[model samples]
Target chain A: MTALPPPSAKKLGLVIDLDTCVGCHACVVSCKEWNSQSPLGAPLADLDAYGAAPEGTFLNRVHSFEVTREAGPPVVVHFPKSCLHCEDAPCVTVCPTGASYKRAEDGIVLVNEDICIGCGLCAWACPYGAREMDGAERVMKKCTLCVDRIYNETLPEPDRVPACVKSCPAGARHFGDLGDEDSAVSRLVAEREGFALMPDQGTKPVNRYLPPRPRDALPEFDVLAPYLEPVTEGAGGFLGWLDRTLGKI
Target chain B: MHPAPSLILFTVLSGLGFGLMVWLGFGALVPLGWVGFVFWALAYGLAGGGLLAATFHLGHPERAWRALSQWRTSWLSREGVLSIVTFAVMAPHAAGSVFLDRPLPVLGALGGGLALLTVFSTAMIYAQLRSVPRWHHWTTPAVFMLAALAGGGLLAGQVAAAGPLFALLAVALALHWHMGDRRFAAGPDTAESATGLGRIGKVRLLAPPHTGRNYLLREMVHVVGRKHAARLRLIALAAGAVVPAVLLVALPAGHLLGALAVLLHLAGMLAARWLFFAEAEHVVGLYYGRR
Candidate 1:
């Protein structure tokens, strides 16, 4: 059962725009907040709360890096990463138990905690570090793509999306069927030139990331230089007279 | 990767156990009656005990039986299935030797082949992981097989065979280390490639995702000190192979000397196995900028 299902046409995935992401960690917070209570999987572990080392599990995480470019001083890129739901998901095949599987219907990778032996081999097999082991429950937890919410009939149509996507304040995370070339997410990916992370890894990740847009360099002369420059040759009016008197003394 | 003591004991002990089984099945030295019982018992105790140790590291030890169902894709699963099959095939053969003092060559040979296959499958579990460049190589299996063979030879009292095997194992271990040490840099994956920021320029971690550590960091981002690793490698080679080889070749073969050699070899193997896990650099660490 760990063997991956035949390729599915519906590649339900996310497209993140790096240009718009501010690295606020709202998606991370939202993901943890929702998945913890969603009843879809085991609750994320939060060990040693309020102690010296507080540890917890989060499916989605936002990492900010300083990319040094030849033209600019340096670019700050906020990278929000999660499970890509890879077409050739190594995590799926490497699983000793049948718990790890990719959906033939949607191409979303999921871990069934009930059967998961939590050997941690799947986590090791994953190149992206998307899975986390819950300390208390001792089960592997990963981004479920909010399967509970996405299919819920009680919620409004607009609200039926991944928790991270719905809660992203910057509107950077877009979720849709990426396999359809005409889908909104796919169009955005095409227009923005979105790319998969570590393409050479051969995971063929369904989710894509839009590279940071080009930024203008700062002016060569400081804008505050004019204000700091002297208004007059010496001190203005009274200060000039006082200076002359002080010099005479 | 984080080298848990349970896993170390599992790999080292089980490998030694299975290695001894290989020689026993090949009709290396089958003692008569009760003596044969003790040898077979030792092999089972080490292998079975080591297997039990593996479950200690799992999150759900009770569900480990489920691991046997996925041999189609998983090497870990294959190892589980193959190990059970090896035991079943060899059990009767071992029983015959212990009770009747007659070794069944055909059944024992089949069981021996299965045992070696199980070890290979175990090696494949790590070697198949492309995420760890050092482990994802042909040398991984070679080193594993050589180590298992050498260790097994020592336990089986194949004194003449142990010396040559230890030498070969030493060379293989050194080669694995020498090649594996440079593999990370040689691989296409890097901090830049992982981030997909290489197109723009060089990438560096200005700040991590969180101030606190996560499971990934705890499990996969283990770093061993350079000097300490070097010292341990020398110790592993000396104690595991060199010393054992020298003992078996130079000194007259006696029970005490053989026991000392085996003990020293086990110690050396323990250190080498420790390094095998501790030194492996997972590609995932590039995201945290730790590897």
Candidate 2:
């Protein structure tokens, strides 16, 4: 007889405040550092480390976007993207080897690398592009929500949070058991108008982002342009000629 | 929807195996001589290789037998069952053709039906994956049918002994090719309405989440260059369908021309099969910043 999954525990989740994020990319680096040494092996891969085509680690990435409002200063939104640990989790059901699965306890989606045949189907099933294949291991890898740190008894109580949450300089990242009505994440969801990325697909992602506050007025682009350093120089003129010759302004 | 090489090989090879079986069975029913025996042998060889290729795609080959149980909900299961049946039928028919004085036409027809069913089932596997808007259509089955007809025509032309069979294969190939072209032209309905956004506005990707390549980008958002795809399509049409038809008409005069046509047709079919996977756009791709 098929065994039933254990009754799910309060879903642990995150609520990111986009308004406060500084786009420092500290979370990206910290996530890589934490997951790189985990039992599942490195979730991130570096290519051409010191060569011409230098590339960094994977796991999570911070994307910086400048959103222009009709009126006000341009808001720089730092979007940190990672596995949302969705409830529906198509990546789990689509796995031909049953290697990718969602934990019944906290709704954390994970991959059992040992059982993975590396067919790469689970990666296709995910709309979020959260999964990445580890070239060295020949298996799929992703964010594990710092499962080792969060559960380890030796770690200090405050440091048990996920690497990204722990390292957020602006206190933009929040982590808690979302299933509890009184949990910090649940309270934030009730008070703030948080939105899920691409919610139509209905993956029921646990992570939520607080939308940036509306701008009342537009920024003066012409005035700001002069103050900002010139990114590229003109083709001809004394300054341009000097820049061309020197390869710098 | 990204047609892996294993799947492409499986579908095309199986289609040829099944199509040849159908033609050979029909010939036997008409009381044709050695022509039927030649087709039966070819069918056995192709079907065997196709089945073996399919096994390589499985993650757990030991548990492959479990796949046969889920036919009620899985086209893949039905394909597995039908492929096995096709092989079981082909073995006896091949034995009779080689050793026995008389070939059983009725038994051959049964085996041929089973093989054809397997091909149709394989086509349905892609057609049923609702996540891929490109594959989830009637055109998918049309492509499978065309592949079989074109492959069968090429095989019939090579044998030379089956004159009427060659003519039928050519006609079927023409019909399938026409249908496939129409389907390929009618691309997926990936409008904003399909994505469930009621607002009327042009949505574009302002920023993607990650900098490095991810599985979704690599698998779902595959973009083949338009000019390259067009060139390949032309090659596939000429080599897979047109050349085989021309060879069928000229087979009586020159045997080498017929042989050359089969080789060209195989290459063309392989190209077409590659495009079939490469060109398909999954609905999940829309979520990953694809316009």
Q: Specify the highest-TM-score model's number.
A: 1
Which residue pairs collide, candidate 1? Answer: none
Question: For each candidate, what TM-score against the reference?
Answer: 0.95, 0.70
**lDDT for each residue of candidate 2 in B1-291, tens digit (9 for 90 to 100):** 455778778777878877777666555333234654566667777877787777676554555565564454446667877888777776666567656746666777787777677878888877665455456567677668656755665565434433334344345434444554444235443323222221223333345555555545566777755348778877877777666666666545465776776777778778778877777666655544452
Residue-level lDDT tens digits of model 1 in A45-147: 7999899999899899889899999986889999999999999999999898899999999999999999999899999999999999988889899999999
Residue-level error in angstroms, candidate 2, position B127: 4.3
Which one is best on DockQ?
A: 1
Please give, for residues A27-67, the per-residue lDDT of candidate 2 as tens digits.
88899888887775645666666776555446776655544
Q: Candidate 2: which stretches are off by over 4 Å?
A: A1-10, A41-44, A54-57, A65-76, A179-182, A216-249, B1-10, B18-41, B44-132, B149-218, B242-261, B282-291
TM-score of chain B of 2: 0.81
Return the DockQ of model 2: 0.11
